[model samples]
Target: MHDITHRNRAESPSSKTLFKATAIALVVGAGLLVTTVLPAEYGIDPTGVGGYLGLTQLNAIAPQETAEPVEDPMISDAQLASLLNPVWKSSAPLRNDTLTITLGPNEGAEIKAQMQEGDRFMFKWEAQGPVNFDMHGERPNAGDEFTSYWTGRNKTNANGAFQAPFEGVHGWYWHNGGAQPVTVTVTTTGFYEKLYKL
Candidate 1:
C-alpha cells in the first residue's frame, strides 16, 4: 500500500516567468512582422531598416511618363484618291511565277517582282536547309536606297502577303550559311508585272 498523499505533484512555471516569456515572444513576433513581413510583402518600410536592406524595392512601382497626343492634318477626298492610285497601269494580263535556285555555302541570291504602289501579292518560300532572308524593296531611280519589310535568320520556310509601298522592285534575298548547298523554292501570285532573278 503506497501513501499517495505524500507523493510530490508536478510544478508549473511561476506566473511572473510565464508572463515574461509570453511578452518576449510577442515582442519578437511584432518586430519580425514590422521589419521583414511588411516591407518585403507590401513595400511598406516603417523603420527604414527595410530600405537599408533593399527589401523595400521588392514591391516598388516604377515612375511613368505621360505622352502628349499629336493631331493629324486632314486631306480632301480628291487628294486621298490621288495618293491611293497605282503609279503604273498595266494593260497586260497578270501572271504567276515559281522560281527555284540553289545557293552554295555562304552564297546569296535575290528575286524581285516588278510592282507598283498598292499592288499586292501572296508569296511562299522554303529552303531545303536553314538560311537567312530579307524581304525588301527599292526604287529604280532611288540610287541604292532600299526599304526593308522583314528579315529573319535560321529559317526553313515562310509564307505571307505583301502590298507594294512604292513603284519599285520588291523581293527577297536569301543567304545560305551551311556547309552544304541549300535550295530555295518560291511561289507567288498577284498583280506583279514580272518575277526576275537579281
Candidate 2:
C-alpha cells in the first residue's frame, strides 16, 4: 500500500481582494438607498397619514356678491293726463277745451300740448305780443287752413306757417312777454275738431 500527500491550494490574492471590495460596495449602496432614494420617490410624511401637499381646495374661493337696481314708481292716470296736456287757464267761462299760459317778464317755459283723440288737426294761435314759435308734429300740408289772430299788429297777417307733419290732433302753446295782459286763443280745426278755441 502507497501513502499519497496532497497539498490544499491557497485562495488567489486577486480573488480575496475582489470578495472584500464587493462586500464593501453592497454595504454602502444599502445605506444610500435607505437615507436618500426611497423618501424622494415615495414621500415619507412625519404624520404617517398620507395626503397631497401644496394642493388647492374648491371651497377656498369666496362666494361673489350680487346686486339689483332700484326702479321708478308708476304714475297715476290723472297725473299722466295732467303732464301730457298741462294747462294753466284762469278762466272767463266757455271752453271748448281751453288752456291758458301767463308769461311774466322775459319768462320762458315749455307747455307740452297733445291731442290724443284726433289724428289730424289745424292748429290756430291768437295772441298779443312778441312770441317765438317752434312746432313739432306732422306739419300741415300747403294751403291747409289754420287761422291765428292776435291782438297785436301782426295778428291778422299769416306771420307763420306750421304744416302738420303727422296726422294727429295738435295744438300750440305760446309764451308772451309784453307790458300788458295777453290773451291767447288756440284752436284745432281738423280731425274731430274738438275746438280747443281758447
Candidate achieving the largest lDDT: 1
Worst 10 residues of 1 by lDDT: 86-95
What shift in Å separates residue 93 of candidate 2 from its native position after superposition? 23
* lDDT of every model, 2 decimals: 0.89, 0.44
lDDT of 2 by residue, 49-149 (tens): 23233112222345687666447567888989888886533222222343456556555333323333323434555555565443433234624554342
Q: Candidate 2, 160: how far from true, in Å?
A: 8.9
Q: TM-score for model 2?
A: 0.29
If scored against the real structure, what TM-score would every candidate get? 0.55, 0.29
**Candidate 2, backbone clash total:** 11
Question: Quick one: best TM-score, which candidate?
Answer: 1
